[model samples]
Target chain A: MKQRLVSPVRMVWLLGALLIVCILASFTLGHYPVPLGQLLGILGSRLGLPIEVSWTPQMETAVWNIRLPRVLMSVLVGACLAGAGASYQGIFQNPMASPDILGASAGAGFGAALSILIGLSSVGIMVAAFAASLATVALVFTVSRHAKGDRVLGLVLSGIMVSSLFQSATSFIKLVADPNNKLPQITYWLMGSLSGAKWSEIGFILPPMLAGLIPLLLMRWQLNVVTMGDDEARAMGVNAPRIRLWTVLCSTLVTAAAVSVSGMIGWVGLVIPHMTRRLLGADYRCLMPGSMLGGGIFLLVVDNVSRNATTAGIPIGILTAFIGAPFFLWLITGKGDHYEH
Target chain B: MSIEVSHLSFSYGQRQVLHDISFQVRQGEFLSILGPNGVGKSTLFRCVLGLLSGYTGQVLIHGTDARSFSVREAAKHIAYIPQSSRPIFNYSVSNIVLMGRSGSLSTFQTPSKADEERCAWALEKVGIPHLARRCYHRLSGGEQQLVLIARALVQDAPILMLDEPTANLDFGNQLLVLEQAKSLTRDGYTVIQTTHHPEQSYLFSDRILALQNGRILTQGAPSQVLTEQTMAQLYGAAVTVVSLYQDKVRVCVPKHITIQEEAK
Candidate 1:
């Protein structure tokens, strides 16, 4: 079927422009608002520009210290998670595959909770989460390697088993944690938030995120060949297993990095890629970048609503589901057979 | 020989699927492999294509051992059209055809503009230029088979291996797909295919290799290899072979249906 949607090129430009607008508008939101001009002036001053500081110190602090890191974290985490999700979906040949399909998010959540109970520093918690996430994926692979039948199905099943294992471990930690301090912290962390965004945390996730994202972006075309299935891939001279390994490694790296910092922001990874596919079609050359931009825009808008919709900021994880589910439903049911082909 | 398999044998764990199968296809020849289900036709193709590495024998493609070649090098020697199945994602027809150029691309490389134009040319050559922008999964069974042929054509290999290209197609589409494959042999392409219909081999193939239980039951020209007794032994059914068009065409008709009708 010929898709009548906006062309892939223009849709990419549209998503990019929308992401920029959302990022700018997010700076204007929150408990302490920074107007657009002062935001630009603050950015210019930071960039060694000759713009005068006509705004107050609090606006500067809000734009530079508070909002900048949080905005960047949201965009990066959003892009990484959604990009990972899209890659996972392609490599696994399952539309239901997501960034968290291989237990990364659950393992990271457990790691963060365990560290919170141990009273570790925030950086330690991030490191612990990252390690635990990777460990979970490694364990899944080892387990699947031993299992018989289809390797992809084996990996997916092992992912489910291991993810639930970690989920129960986190629950046990929650049960034994100190109710007043560690309990609330763990619970809030599990719910997910970008409120604690810091420059150091950004630095920590950046290298791994770039390491993960750059390869995925570069290998997007190969991802298309891989979706034709393993036997077909091998016959066509695209090394399916090697491509699958690299894809899993890179996507897992990105997922682990995003989850370590952002707690458990869930729906953006799973839903944003599908939404981008609806708009841009299933070509990964476009879908990869499209998911990144669509995810950044989606999560940025959700984060804006999270921090600004109420006097007490809502946790982003909650807002993502609240907003993401309905919007995704509308995209699916409202459209006339967008995915039917 | 364009392709040769020497004493190729494969097994899964304790059970062997293909047992010392041997065959050859000469240059510009259309060879049809006929067999029933579970006869290891697909396993043989996989062995030849290097998808199965544990097989015991050598598959030489144009004097080079098929196993010695890397995946890309294998693609240069042979193009494959796998059985048509619905893919998870609905890729555009042009995009699916474009993937045939992937053997020439590096790990991080995409199909260039030249590759895209070649993809278009292959589409035109396959007579599916009108469906270039259509979704692959939305096409009819025959149309999907043609799209896959277009993809194989884009690979630009001298030898083509098709695994039951007409399995799920209607009668007209079956003839259409077989016609396309048969015509390619005229253009100096070595085409090897597997089929369930014995009559199709009679009509289109230069040689027939019949398999029974992973063993070569018979091989040669269709007339000699497709007698009533051989057909019955191969498929374990009562059948009769008859000539048509003043002995120019031959067909196998199962006798059980007529006997049951006469009894009724």
Candidate 2:
């Protein structure tokens, strides 16, 4: 029971260093490879700093225009999803709870697909996806409010129903979409990619992501009380219902924002928090930041593999499942007893 | 009085669960509520904790109406130890104990040094400082219950309400937990506990209240309230009360059934 892992402080440093390395490696090794020095030089030039190195326009474009934004997006989206997932799991007091448990991903997927079908602009698609995700969560909340017996179970059950409803809607959109024109685009989007990640998109995602993340980070200690169950939390002087509502709201917002940008990147949200918990015990004060850093590093590595491992870049969503599924299997089977207690 | 409930009644939809229940607990007094299943002992605890609303009468904590108390305000006066259940996540024992300080801490603030000291003190008081760093869910049922009691102690509440504190424990652990609870009254903590064992009530409680069908069948000192007739009527089984230890200690034993014994 007292088997020691790395201390939490050192764990944070390790993950942070790994994230930095992944970011730098992702910048240096892409389809159009830029050397590390030139990559740094190009970054410095863009930041209006004096650096003595000759860098070509193509290297600058690849480093600044394409790879940097994609890498940053992956980090933010990964962190956002992981943070949301951890919060959801704590609030529900269920280890299996994830960011997509309440239909946010499904709703965003349907919105993105519908926008593609209707030929909306990229901004419009993102906005539509965001709005749809929020709407779907609101619907789930309304439905679960009317449900009797075990409020958390009610929310989860309602989430399943609403997710299926949105999933069918997405399927219908795909079916009716123009096969040659919109179909491939919709399919690729559903599979999820960071290929289209742009610097402008960061502006759109950063605010909501921070808005959702900051509150959860601040309330991490209170979340421990929440996991003790509602009646117990209440008796301990924590307003379980109010804290739960805020948690749900923040998690849904962050999750929807991430999905809208990254197109249904799965597994990172569900797996990263569990991985962090194994290393750090289930104290949310450590778990929240640990999961955030772990998730960022995880996706950075996955995104790096997706882009560099193949001539034609693999979609990140596919790679996440490929890596995450096996890892999850090992987690549940290998260390299952640790989690069960 | 540390806690008082007067004519408190509660219902779920059309069916009533607690009917005209009244009780008063003084400072440092140990009151054990004895009841069979479905007799609303838990419901009464909830009412006193202000977790239930729309009840018929009043619950007064330190002479103030309980209905007006916020969750934090209630926590200041009363700490509750629920029956132990396994948590989903494996939190460290220290973190689990630290959660008791949540009522006093602000929403965004972490536990201060003083608060941590109090948590450590509570753990030491419960005699489980060795288990402080162990994962809470990894502990035994008795150990988990002890941690919960330590959590209640950290809350620094005057009145402690425990619902079946020894329900799932082994015989030794049951005695250990009950002994700990009984000792708290000596430290100026008013304890209200619901228990199934009449002998435990007889041994540990200064006052005993026997509840059946949401009503108090009898309420007084343990020797007067816990009689063979009331025990039989409460559980619908014939029983005999016997005294031992120079007629100071009382115990209840079931009367043997002639038919069942012959079949056996």
Candidate 3:
């Protein structure tokens, strides 16, 4: 008999409810502690509903300007990264694969570091990072094309080599920067914090994220065939190489955009997809959306903790690693067979 | 003819694998390719599938040039089943079978109600309708082979090509898979398979093609092609052919080298 824990429809409904609850709770439970009634009143007033203006302008700014943008960015970036990771895992047919498996993160890091060293504006840095990430994947694809046997294995090996190449370039940029000003900026950016997130930056990320993610959603079912290995997929009349190329391109675009905005947040991409697979089956129709929602909630909760945990906001990259590593260890030790087919 | 190949030759950068191979398969015929390891059986299959290019050959499927057909177009006429291996993901059996319909599906379109009905029919035809909802990876080897056969059956192609269908099966399971292949021929499907077992070819195949040293050594009816002399020449070992049950069953047994030396 098939062992199903929860039907996919029910799982989707449950995740949607949890996401809504998490968003509302995050808006209310920050350091400033806006009351729920006032929060609703503020929203209701903006929507032109008759509600009392019980909150001060400072509370209004904190909710709308400060907290809302960060929270929204958290959800968007989280969904993009996790969705891209799931797509990569399917294309490569490896559960261990993530968004950065093909050096997207490393390439973006190098681009951001170089831009910061040359005194580029904030927007310039992000644009450079996004471009470099795509460039890195293109380079990796070219190298793999020259490799003779086993195309998937070739891509993975070349990805590792290209990643190291970009990482060293990033290190070189960090070495020559001014220590007090430019070095600290570069280091903090690499460490990843959402403290200074703004509506404009969120606007910058949305288009590319959608451009990459929408195709992934549409091709979700096709991903099942691609993951079945190349020969089988070819026998099914799928252009395996072409589908793989499209998947990689879309995944790289979204992952690069997310990393450029958030500055190298880890673990959400790698862990959320596995967690989703364990809850739902490996059907990408369910796995893709499940990972997106799961990643959003995970990052939102983590960002909430980062802001409220102390006076100085902890770097999100550190916190994700702090939480992600232990959780991954537990999953490995307790439920290793869940990953094995 | 369902499939016709003439003077097919292939090489891997100066290392020749298949040399001057020519054969024709008629409608509803079961052709068994018998060869030792590294005798270019798989390479020949790849060439037929249009997976390997730069081969000197003329392969026609239903009087259409195979080389001119795109991969998808070729798939409409011929379906391929690789040897069954454990998949990395535990997808449902129905989902696995539905992938066979991909050749006919338009881009961005999900499987429709008709496609689902076809998948159901395939599972029923294979006599494993109960396994449709079960995880594919949990099935046994024989069951997995049957599932793959059903997957091919769902392709709706007239010609089916299998690579070592019973390569990993045990004795009884091997017979089970072979019987399934044999049954497909009776349904007007042209089935071609590569196998190492000569007795299986004798029992189920309408024709046998023996390959040795990257060349065809013999090609004819099983009775004419699978003689004791040809069997010994193909394997480079002494073998004896025996018949039983009023000469209705044929088997090949290899002579023991140690016993022969002691007697000498």
Candidate 4:
């Protein structure tokens, strides 16, 4: 047990293997069940390998159109949320910080709700959400700049203020929405789902997600020092303000991208980093990558269960809380002394 | 001089925290700033470390204006060990110490193998090599202080500034931390520290600077600066400065404690 606790590299490798298995399982276990052998052939054939085409045309269409996009979105969004969550925790030096701390998710939700009220296309909703989320964080930063004392506290308070501002705007949109059509659409979007994942949406969100994740991954070491607090980080030559600005900007970028595409998926960003911290100590160097991989595996499995648990598809945001909260409680309770409140 | 502060003053809006304070510390000198809580010792150190700006006067580290240097360049000249704060996350001792090399590394770079070796060497030097892989939060206060000192060691700066390095330790642990700091001064690092205890200044510091309301009240060799009158004025309590071990050491006792003993 201690051996497992000590070796984060090995655990990361294990998570990597588990993710590959989950992706393969998620591919085969969806609504239109494709067998493992034919699934491999389809994937291989798509990659230009000369594999025999024994799968049906509908099966291929299901694999390409529905399963592939959802699978990739789950993995990509999970990694992005978890990575951004870990970065937020590090830069803020607050364990409670998540990707939503800066109002990105709330802002994105409002954007989607407003776009839906205006009857925008699916892509238009994603774009509007992306824009609104960025704007919300920008407003938070501007407000916090004028706040007196403690930059971290200022950012957090303004974030709460702006987030609730946008949330009320979303509620107002819901109140005014057509009860027969737009209200339920807004409610379901707020709860979040991956059922509508499309190849085009994936193509649009992927670049920004990578753009956010790469800089955060590269700056993991700096993230570790930032956790020591601003004065200490600066004293150690880490340039705390610059690192903070970059972290907020990047974390906000990834979070906005994730929320715009997947709606307000909650618990992954909040709990996944904590889970990874328990598995691989709190060094962001390992914690960043670990949370990324762990998040991907978790969401993929959760997404699979959400789709396959019953005849009707459950909104993933609800399931994430239903699944994540209990699991998180179990993790904290077992060897409860290890965690700080 | 390793560090020079001349006519330094700071205010937090309407409240003046520090008045004109001037001092110079030479390389290889252990200068202890002695004061009670809220006397602005920490604020003074912050000014010296370039963590604070908008002061009235100049702070020079190695004869260069502190404000001109970037955080990295300032760190290269002087490393700081803050009070042993309980961190939110539990990083390993080695990992915590290895962060000392961050100033030398680029923004995108992590610690190299050489940096790892240097961290190990610092832990060994601080006599906590066994705790390298142990979680930092689980360590005793004394051990944590040592870990921070080791971190400062790995920073490889010529000057080390500690903000009350022993404020929260037990009696034996306090000596342990002070001795480690004194040893660093012997290794030719300029050490400046703040503390409320005059005995700590007497035992470890080559010179003592006493502060009252953020202004320099007195400064000189420990014997001259820590007299009974100065101690009483600084703490607002009568204290008897006692010489020990053939005048080689001294300690202060509150007058009431001595009176109570005599009554007993």
- Candidate 1, residue B207: the lDDT equals 94
**lDDT of candidate 3 over B34-140, digit per residue (tens):** 98999999999988887886899788899998899876888788888888756677677888888899888865667888998999999998789988887788778
CAPRI-style quality class for the chain A–B interface of candidate 1: medium
Assess every candidate by TM-score.
0.96, 0.96, 0.95, 0.96
Residue range B1-264, candidate 2, lDDT tens digits: 998889998999999999999889999999999999989998988889888988999999999999898999989899999998577888778888899999998888888889889989999998899888787877889999999999999998989999999999999999999999999999999999999988888999999998999999999998997788888888887877888897567877767754465578
Query: Which regions of candidate 1 are displaced past 4 Å?
Result: A330-341, B256-264
Candidate 1 has which clashing residue pairs, if any?
none
For model 2, name the residue pairs that clash: none
Pairs with steric clashes in candidate 4: none
Clashes of each: 0, 0, 0, 0
Residue B209 shift from truth in candidate 2, angstroms: 0.8
Candidate 3: tens digits of C-alpha lDDT, residues A295-316: 8999999999999997788999
Poorly placed runs, candidate 4 (over 4 Å): A1-6, A334-341, B254-264
Model 1 per-residue lDDT tens digits across residues A225-267: 9988988887788998899999999999999999999999988
- Report the TM-score of the second chain of model 4 against its true counterpart: 0.96
* Candidate 4 residue-wise lDDT at A63: 89
Against the hidden true structure, what lDDT does model 1 obtain?
Answer: 0.89
Name the runs in model 2 displaced over 4 angstroms. Answer: A337-341, B257-264
Model 1: per-residue Cα lDDT over B1-264, one tens digit each = 998899998998898898888888999999999989999999898889888889998899999998899999998888999878577876888889988999889989989999999989888877888988888877899999998988888888999999999889999999999999998899999999999988888899999999999989999988887788789888987876878997568877779776786799
How would you order the candidates by DockQ, starting with the best?
1, 2, 4, 3
Q: Please report, in order, the local distance difference test score of every candidate based on alpha carbons.
A: 0.89, 0.89, 0.87, 0.90
What does fnat come to for each candidate? 0.71, 0.71, 0.38, 0.70
Error of 1 at A282 (Å): 0.3
